[model samples]
Target: MPFYHKLGKIPQKRHTQFKQPDGSLYHEELFSTIGFDSILSNAYHINPPAKIDSIEKVIVDASPVEWDAGLRPYHFKTKGLKFELDFITGRKPVLFNSDVIMSVCRPESQMDYFYRNATCDELIFVHEGEGMLESNFGFLDFRKGDYIVIPRSITFRLVHKTAPRLLVFESAGPIKTPKRYRNEFGQLLEHSPYCERDIRAPERLFTSSDKGDFIVKVKKENKIYSVHYDFHPFDVIGYDGFYFPWIFNIDDFMPITGKIHMPPPIHQTFEAPGFVVCSFVSRLLDYHPLAVPVPYSHSNVDSDEVLYYADGNFFSRKGIDYASISLHPGGLTHGPHPGTTEAALGKLETVETAVMMDTFKPLKLTNFARELNDENYYLSWKD
Candidate 1:
């Protein structure tokens, strides 16, 4: 988040004694990043936030095994993915590297225990579902097309109202609004595609005073550990900060347009250390009389491109459909399909929606991705 937000009750000043009804001082916990040098929040809790009952056990290995997928353009059909119970275990990694891991999750069951990803920030795209994201910061209602950005170490759980189909990204560093979209003071600029008003932070706090064994499945270094806390994780009475979970819907993005076909950066939605996420939504096409209204063939020598088709017609693609993921590695030149460029001539607009991730480092495929791979996708450009 680029702006400041405060929810629930807070004291007049920082580090001040905020007494509860029983006269005991409210516990103040500082949620910070980059060793207190970066964004942080002051959270006042009903009980001490670090009351550990016991280290129960190691739950499961959450690491994705890399499969040898030789460098070439590939397409994955994810519509056939099987549903799994719970949100954490349901994630099936498709592509990953040191900086980011991309996965598709079809969770049939809701989460029973709270989850805290200790090592990576999460960017979850709700492809198909409506749910409430309950976190220590507060509770946020998320629906389809919403990108829920959860920072690392946030104790949270997904309460599903319907079966969720999600595209999840685990980033090694903080996921942030593109720097170009913000000013020096961290406020979104007027020309930005989306502003603070379009971003939804947790408005309702879920303060709990219950005491007992509360299970929190924590993920750190690709391992899941079940930790038992003496008090409920959502014990925060108030919090004020920029470091919290937020929701940004794809529909709210106003597409940037030009007389000539614009590049991928114009569609950028979020940025991380090694990758940038772009959203392709319904928008007007290039107005140039000679414009093709589609992307031209280009070999991006610096990054790999992955596009997850969410909805609508993808004019540049032929075989891709909803829930299809196309990977174009750095070495290959990919563009509009064989006849797509010629077909797109004289088009006034595009009613397509997709999510694209361009990673600076090369991504490796997982076994699940290999199973869903369309072996002949690279040959689609052949006349």
Candidate 2:
């Protein structure tokens, strides 16, 4: 999570009457997590946030299309995914489990209405595009290589300046920076890969006091509900707290190197209940004279590994380009593809950029994912 942020007009004390220009009190709403025990924000709105005009349930069967369970690894080529013009409609779920859902979307256009995922926190990796994420908290500008994190139940919309391609991760639990990187006071430590300066919060406010029919598409329990509000969803005039949407660029993540190769935990960026998100940025290899820079083949005992190739040359694998995903499920032995270890023996650096997710639960592949499967990927290691 990002640090405390505030925008627009707010009262000196929360829960107090903050009057508007016409002597009317601004509606005070407390947005929090974990039933107010966790991080929270206090926002003053122009209208009551609970005023709803109507609600319609839109059933979307998001259940994954799974294949036979196996011990083999899989590779999906999602570089050519076909997405519709709308943002929500274009999302194609490729892998999912009880803990998390991983999907890809290449939206041809912008979202028409607002959205609030009541069930999960959204971690959207901007693979290819520029856009502004407008929410009740404020406006957050995002570009390629950025991980835009939106806390659960925050109404927002993505306004893309160009055709946007995104890799989305929905966490059943709140997504936060690795606790080890933060101090007891919740501030990032000096040794952390990224600092507060690298984290970008919503800088500008986008408050709307307009009264009209506004649609907010809410996702709850694997179903989308069209909720119509009597007032604009962005009616928030001001808000302040530790809970808000923020962005962290993958390029800003400084990889930690050592005499010998480091473990995957060193690359962890975000963590949830049953999963962790990692950023594999371009960095120097191990400095040990005889060290093998490429990772050694090992068995993942209780976690499944998913890697999404964003950009740069991935020297460890073949036939993987931008937007390619490789899944190494639990109980399988995987590592640098054949010959990668030998090739990296004398290498000083690698220019590979990728996003990786390690989940405790096994992920099921969707039928749409099967369409883009590289059936021969499992045999790529054969001589």
Candidate 3:
């Protein structure tokens, strides 16, 4: 997040003596990034956050291994994924590299314990279902088409009202609004498609003073550690900072169109160190008399392109349906399928909704992705 926000109660000045009702000092914790030079927050907790009772055991190894998939375009159907009980355990990695890991999760049950991703920033796309994201900062209500951006080391859990179908991304760096959309002061410029008003931060703080054995599954260095604490993880009385979890819905994105077909950068919604995330929503097409509304064929010489189809019709793709993921790796020239360009000649608008990730580094498919891949996708452009 590039904007400042405050939730709950905070002292008039930071690092001051804030006493509790019992004449005890509230434990103040500094949540910072980039060695205290970047965005940070001051959170006051009822209990010391570092008071861990024990390290119970080590959980599953969450690292993704690269599959021996030859370089080519690939398509995967996520509809066949099985429903799992735990949100953290339900994620199935599909493509990954040194900088990013992408997965699809279909969780049938709400999280019973809290979870914290200690190493990577999580960008979750809510493809289906509704839920509330409970975090130390506060609570955020989410629904379908919402993108929940959880900064690394945020203690949180998902309370789902219905089974959730999610597309998750684990980025090795901080995920923020596109730099081109912001000014020198970090505020979004007027020309940006979405503004701060569209960004939803935590609204309701959840304070827990109960004492018990609370388990927080923390992910770090590709493994999950079951750490036990004597107090509730969401014991924060208040917090204020620019570095808290936030949400942005794709439906709120205002698509930028032109008389001629616009490039993919115009749809960029978020950016990280290795990749850029784009949103394609319902919008009008090119208005030029001789314009081709569909994109032109081109090679992604330095990046890999991945698109997750969420809903509506994909005007430039063929044989693609809801919950399908298409990967066009670097060194490949991909564009509108077969006769999609000719078919889109006179179209006025498109109702397509999809999420696209373009990574600077090459992505390797995971073993789980191979089982659902459409091997013939590379030849789908044949006339």
Which ranges of candidate 1 are over 4 A from the true structure?
none
Q: Estimate each model's TM-score.
A: 0.98, 0.97, 0.98
**Steric clashes per prediction:** 0, 0, 0
Provide the overall lDDT of each model, using Cα atoms, as 2-decimal numbers: 0.93, 0.88, 0.92
**Candidate 2: tens digits of C-alpha lDDT, residues 1-383:** 64778888999987888999999999999988887788899999899888889997566665556765466788899877776766677788888989898989998877889999999999999998898999988998899999999999999999889778899998899999999999998899998999999999999988887887899988887788899998889988898999899999999999998899899999999999999999999998899999988888888899999999988888888788778999999887887788777876899988988999999988888777788888888888886
The CA lDDT at 171 in model 2 is 89
| lDDT of model number 2 | 0.88
lDDT (C-alpha) at residue 311 in model 1 = 92
lDDT of 3 by residue, 116-207 (tens): 99999999999999999999989999999999999999999998898789999999999999999999999999989999999999999999
Candidate 1, residues 1-383: lDDT per residue as tens digits?
Answer: 77889999999999988999999999999998999999999999998777788886546888899899798899999988888877888899999999999999999887879999999999999999899999999999999999999999999999899878999999999999999999999888998999999999998998999988899999999999999998999999999988899999999999999999899999999999999999999999999899879999999999999999999999889899789999999988888888888888999999988999999999999999989999998898888
Local error of candidate 1 at residue 102 (angstroms)? 0.4
Give me candidate 1's TM-score against the actual structure.
0.98
Cα RMSD, model 2 = 1.3
